[model samples]
Target: MAALTPDTVDIIDPDLYVRRGYPHDEWAVLRREAPIYRYERANTDPFWAITRHADIVNVSRQPELFHSIQRLFVTINEEGSPAPDEAILRQLLNMNPPEHGAYRAIVNRRFTPRGVQGLREQIDRITAEVLDGIVDRTECDFVTEVAARLPLAVIAEMFGIPRADWAMMFRLSNMMIGPGDAEYAGDETILETLQRARMEFFQYFSQLCEDRRQNPRDDLASVLANGLVNGAPLPIFELMSYFALLIIAGNETTRNATSGGLQAFIENPAQWARLKGDPSMAAGAAEEIVRWTSPVIQFTRKATADTNLCGVPIRAGDELALFYPSANRDEAVFDRPGVFDIGRNPNRHIAYGIGEHFCLGANLARLELQVMFRQLAERLESVESAGPLHRMRSNFVGGIKHMPIRYRMRPRA
Candidate 1:
């Protein structure tokens, strides 16, 4: 393969992601040769690419220095789109600490480890129901048949959405984040697909919000619809953006992680067998899978003030893209980083990221992965890749889009 050059390291190019898996080799080069690399493209802004794990951590920890409030999250190319409230994206994805903390606190308790663990039986039930759909099949596309359904079910239930609408939500999420992919967008440009999806999302969620207000339930949607932020009920746009984030972010991250995690198990039979023997290893297994997948590819931050990162000078307002996939594979952090290990100890992967902006749904996502994999380890007789694996042609949120897996399954308990 030819060496990746400056022109090819944008990290947000959808073509590169479709052709290469996670851009590992290119990131390795960046980490060792130029950890704070820079890249520029046509009609796009030039920004510093933060590749090394430590650099990502440093930037994340100091949110005051690297602010997300500058009207962007990771990529400027996809910024400034039509939505319910065009400005709400900033409030949701780019809020500063004081404000970010307030909104995050609205429903934070429901996503904590304790809160998430409380739903283990429910998660297990959801997993079981989804698995039952595929139990009799000799071969299936695990991507859609199994992995995609689990997160949609869990999150839909959380949002108090009707079961009938879960599939719609999942489809809208794909169209929202995957405009660059033919499977999702077909011929639509990024902004066009995103705007179209946003309209659908706004139309549906707007009704749901009103319904929740009239008939509140013990769900996240009801909470957000009725809840107040800073002595004021969330503005309509903020409310809509919150729902949009939940639908898109909530679905894509976990969905991709599950799909990619299953592929990992099939690829590393020994690791799969290890888990089969000891289901308790599901904890470490979750971290390893998230590390391996790193579905939420890159998170960006804008410099609030001039500073230096690992001796590299940075200017105020400069965007820094944190390549989470690369950080997870940093050789300095994990032993044999390239190899997949279900039982890797001290696996300090920054997959969910660090600092205040760390993934709020991390606990829930971890629990979902653990429960699903544990069930597989118990009931799965054997499994392996059965055909060519296809990935979502999306650069931001991506994973196996079509994976044919041949597997034998034992009767469910």
Candidate 2:
């Protein structure tokens, strides 16, 4: 193949890609010709888009050589440079090892199998409540009414956040993740909605921290408030940053995954039937959904030194966007790369990522999905589309923004 150039490579406009429905065909072309191709926008720094599974895994495994501390995504600010909020960037996902491992260890205990196992009853109750609301309404938007709300509610409860502020938090999360989406676009006034959301989040968590210090509780917020890292109590800013990270990471990703899972089952009715027939397949089906949706699409890594990835040269400070969607669909890895199979065994897809930066909340997410699906499958007598599905205009975390579904509810025994 001819040497890939900036001009030859596709300069994807995030907004356009989301609006037009990001087809996998273009990605297939890029994977073959320019697996590590340079993509430059008129007003943004050039980035190398890594589309192949091997390259993504290679980059992720070498956290020392390919640093995540620079900036975790290909996004740029209004000044045509990487955003300068190091506090925000230092969250679990963007931190390099040692520091990352230290902070992760503090909160890891809460998300363990033992910890999450305790939440099974709570999750079931919440799932039942959400389903009850949906059952009464003949038609409803699955994203807004069902999928989106449940996770946020669960997350807020986990954090001990006031119930009244849950909607605001959800809105802020949407703005943060949906910046490229046309619906989320706001007036280019003082600051971006995402930045505003970050400030709001910091303020809220700061108050929560103070409260926790005065009266610590059993919730995650209290743990964060009283938690120590590197043998010292976490600083206030770092605590707020950690809270911000948890809120966004815990709430939005799961919301998208749940919404996406429902859509997948709807699209593949036979697979849905198979799952419905055998509820034991819920766990496997959840894995397939994550693999199929591939939420948290791309995370960036900065090359610490000059290196070659899959025969392509990369220089120090060069940014590489590890496209998880592409990796999950790699023909070499999956049997039927395009097809969605509910009972796919050994589904080692990198949806939650891999290596050092693997999602800390992976178990929590899996448990949530398994329980949610189990409840839905058992209680929903019939489910079908009521209207067209509207996908969120986001490249970072992509899924349905709105799905109108009509369902016949089965009575709870």
Candidate 3:
């Protein structure tokens, strides 16, 4: 890998993510040379990129100092902080301890190991059905046909959303995270695109909530609609934002991870073969894939008071981007960081994030990935890139969006 120069320091550029799947070598330099390097582009306040594993842990641990409410996206300081009246980030993100904990607890039980374990049979059924859709075809866009399908279904079924609406849910989720991409944004500004998606999401979910209230079901939607926090009903807007986050955030991360996982197997066939040789390795392989692919690239944190992180200077109101992809590969934490070993041990990857805001769906995602590779190891005969792989032009949900794969698979039993 070439040295990163001043000409190449614009790591936040969305184009860079699309070009290299990620700026891995560049990030490697940051992790090695400057774990907390301040990054700046034109017309915006600079932010420290927290590239090392330890530094990220420190930041995540002190959520009170590094707030999550004012900014959930990387464009936080750039787009201006989410205002009190207009910003629902407080609901989806930008939260402090007690508020964050109570809100997160609503669905926390369902995503626990014991909770997600109950869904294993359903997950297997969905995985088998999704794979079955692509098995007969000699070629398919693995992203749309397979990787993107199961998570959408899992979340929709959890919400009691009808199967017929999964496609719309998928499209809407992309619009929420993929506004910077030309395919989703068109001529609109990113804010405009996000706002538009939120508006549509709000309208649809409001009706969904109303129905759940009138005719409750034993599902996540009903739980949320009727859910109580401090013995009071959740505020309407906040509840709506939670619904939006569950659909968009919950759906996108797993979907992108599954796609990125397959891409990893294709690139590192030895790992694929290793998994094929032993289906039981699926559990560890799934973590390696998440660590390797890092579907959610960046999340923002803001400083509430003066602080020094890993011997670096800091100040109140300072903003930082926790580059999860880079942190997952920190040489200090991961031995032979560049290698992709399916059985890599002590895999403390933060792909699902860490600390207070650790991804609520982490257990579910792990199960989904484990199940996916297990079946693939057992059934997939061969898989390779059929055409040029294309990544989503996103700085947020880093993913391979157009993965055309040529493959053969045994029929589902």
Candidate 4:
């Protein structure tokens, strides 16, 4: 194989990720040779590939200059136009500072350390239930059976969704996030599938909003449905968008982290033993796992004004893709960028991102991961792969579609 260069590499290719996981080799090359390389590919829009950790932070911090509004998320250049209702894309993720801050403040209190701590007991219960189901079995698909369940239950309960609707939520999210994958991809084009998923989401959330408005409850759904923003009800589109964001953000990324974390442990048995011996390291382990599996691959932001980053001059309207996985493993910051050390201290991986637009559910995600791995560390006795690993065919989210594992566990004492 020839050496990969900025010109030869195609990082945004969804098929590249499905066939071979994270292009760390390609990213390493870019990080060293051209941390701010201009990536121009056929079919996809040209953008600067921000590979270094410091550069990503520099771009993420100044939301005023590098706006998130122009380009919300990175697409793999699918063959169809998106839904005409572009208002659905006007969620919190795509907003700029003042508006972003305001919308974020709506549910900000619930995701704070204090708020997430309140849900710790619930998370513990959910984790126990999920593990209990697999304790009697010798083999299970960890991604679907174990890793995916806990977060789904937790987030569903938060929304006051019935247990029956969990499957619906799961299917919808997969369609939205992994539309490029054969399993999720239908006869329709990727954008059309996305539009259909969004409509399905809209229909469900619209009814939920109506129900909550008539008889509000303590769940996040009810809070958003009836809650006032700026002394008025939130627009219907924004409300639905809010629900959709929470459902996907709260579920998909966390499950991937959990599955990827376990995969790391299986590969690095010594680290598993280290964590198993001292469960107290779960906090650090969670952080390490997030860094190891930066689920959100890349998000594009457009320069609001012509400026410079890393000595490279940026023209206004130029878009840049901040590669989170690469930033998480940058050599300048982390001690051993490639090593997955569970007890890596002072680990400041920006898997959840940095600055004003940092993930709103970050604290909750940390809590979920910490509690989850702690339980696994205490009970997971032995484990290994039962079949070939399957990854989501999407460059946007580094999703593990299926990870079958055979394992034993010490019964909960």
Candidate 5:
């Protein structure tokens, strides 16, 4: 094959991905033309967009060769720069082997099946309360009223924070993830908004840390406040970074997944009927929803050394964009790739990513979704779209921002 150039390969566009209106059509063309494609834009680092499932697995499995410790996204600033701050760079998702292993080990216990299982009653009660508040309304913004608040409350409980702070945290998390979204725009640019959010998050967590240190509780924050990592209390910055990750990863991603799943169901009423007819299908439906939505659309990995991926040559400094959405829709992996079916067996999707960097909160997210869907199916007698849905303008972590839905409650059994 001829050496691939930027012109020949369809440069993966961040704006198109952000809009997420018709991404699969573009992805289909890219997958066939250039499975290992190079994307270059005006204000971002040039990267190889890995679109195939096999290639994504290959890249993720070899973390040393395809490092995640470097630039984590495709977009940059007005000056065309990559990630530049070391203090901000040392989080678990951005660290390599031995360090990543050690750091991940510290909190791995908290996210295990048993650990999450312990929170089942709390999660069920929380889900019930959320649904109770809105089940009677004829129409409501599902994003704000249900999807957004549920996960925020869950995380607040986990961190022992006030539920009233959800709105502020939600806004900060949006600014943190909304790369090019206009809602987060202000006199300060996107980068400034991100910086400000980080600072505010750090400050808030710092105060929480002080409280936890003085009067520890049973929550994760209390554990981190006094627990020893590498025989010393976790550093304040590192603790804060973990808190930030929990807020973004724990709160926003799940919220997006829930809302996006509901939107998917609304779009495909047959699938909704399948889920409603047999609530046993809730678990399978949840998987299908995540597969369809692919909430964390893409994550970045840096090349540690010269490598050849899917027969495409990559240099030492090259970056790889692991397109999770593309991988979930890979024809080689799933039959009738475009069809949305809750009955997909052996659905080994990379929505939660793979390897050591796999989302620690995956089990919690799964539990939350499963319970939410089950409850929604049981409580919602009839549900339909009341108006047009609005999606967040973000290339990464894409989902419906606003979904107006008219719903009626099912009579109590």
Candidate 6:
């Protein structure tokens, strides 16, 4: 590939993402030459690409300076503004400051280390069961079978959703998050698919909300339904967005991280050997996997006022794309950014992001990854790819749509 200039590189294009996994070559160029490169492309809204770790941290930390509400994300194909309904759906991801805190407080306790710790036995059971399904098989699609199962079951159980409805949650999340991929995009436009997904979730959750209200259960859905935000019930739209965000955020990121982490181990057998040798390294390995995968690819933040980032000028409304993957790989931060080291010490990758709007599900995600990988390390004897890897055609979420692997594992003990 020719050396890409800021004028030539189009990082937001989903097609480019599908053809080539991340544009690290392009990111490296920008990181070296222009850490805060202004990205301008036709049709798509122009924004500054913050590639370096320091700059990303600075921008992410100062949410007041760079607002999250102006625009929640960067779109690959921007035909026009966000749909009318999309504007009304407010969640922690798009909220800023006091409001973000208040909303997050609703379930914050439930996701803290202590809160998530309560689910350890549950997570372990789910992991063992998932691994058990693959123990007798010589080959399986790790993405769909192994990686996707734990998170889906865990989140559904938390919401008090029936086992039958878990598949709907999975389908809705895929359509909403991976609509750029042909597998889920179908005949509708991306925006259309997204809008339809929101409607379906609203319809489903609306009933769940009503049921939970009348017949309250000790579940997250009941909590949200009866919970108050600022001394009042959560508006229908916010309630729906909360459910959607949790289901997607909890499911998608962890699923991709597990699948991608396994791929990393396969390519770096030394790391795999080290992990298998010491299952205690599972916690550090989980952190490394999150850093390596950087599942939530990029989120857009607009400048609330005229402010400069890393010596780059910005107008009040100028948006900046915080490229998490690039930051995770910045040479300034990690000793060997490219190496997949499971036992990397002092790992401070901001895959969950930084500051005010950091992922609310961070603790839960960490717990899930740790349990899954630890179980695999102890039980999975040998593993290798069985077929080509198929990745989602999505630049937003770094997703592994399908990963076939032939592996040996000990049966549940």
Residue pairs with backbone atoms closer than 3 Å in model 3 (clashes): 68-94, 68-95, 69-94, 69-95
Taken over the whole model, the C-alpha lDDT of each candidate is 0.83, 0.80, 0.83, 0.88, 0.80, 0.87
Question: lDDT by residue for model 3 over 32-110, one digit each (tens)?
Answer: 7777888776634578888888898889988888887455546423342233235743374666788889888888898
Going through the candidates in the order shown, the clash numbers are 0, 0, 4, 0, 0, 0
Model 4 regions lying over 4 Å from their true place:
81-88
Model 2 clash pairs?
A: none
Candidate 4 lDDT, tens digit per residue, 1-413? 99788788778888889889999989998999999998887767778999999999999989899988534555556666453224435688788888888788888888999988999999999998899999999899999998899999999999999999999999998888876676886777777777788999999999998999899999999888877777888887788888999998899999999999999999999999999899999999999999999999998899999998878999998889999999998999999889999889899999999998898889999999999999999898899989888999888889998999999987887
Error of 1 at 62 (Å): 1.1
- Residue 244 C-alpha lDDT in model 2: 85
For residues 124-219, write the lDDT of model 6, one tens digit per residue. 999999999888888999999999999999999999999999889999999888866668868777777777888999999999999999999889
**TM-score: the better of candidates 1 and 3:** 3
lDDT of 1 at 225: 87
lDDT of 1 by residue, 1-413 (tens): 66676556556666667777778888888888889987677645677888889999999999788887533434435444333224524444678878899998888888898888888888999999988888888898888888888888888889999998988998888887776677888677666787788889889989999999999999989988887899889988778888898777777888889888988887888898899999999989999999999998886788889899888889997888888999999989889999999889999999999998889899999999999999989988989888887877766676667888888888789
Compute the lDDT of residue 74 as modeled in candidate 3. 62
List where candidate 2 sits over 4 angstroms from the true fold.
1-11, 41-43, 76-89, 188-191
Off by over 4 Å in 1: 1-10, 41-43, 69-91
Across residues 143-234, which tens digit of lDDT does each residue of candidate 2 receive?
Answer: 88888877788888998999899988887777666755556646532136556777888888889999998999999999999999988998
**Local lDDT at 333 for model 6:** 94
Give the TM-score (vs. native) of candidate 2: 0.93
What TM-score against the true fold does each predicted structure earn?
Answer: 0.94, 0.93, 0.95, 0.97, 0.93, 0.97
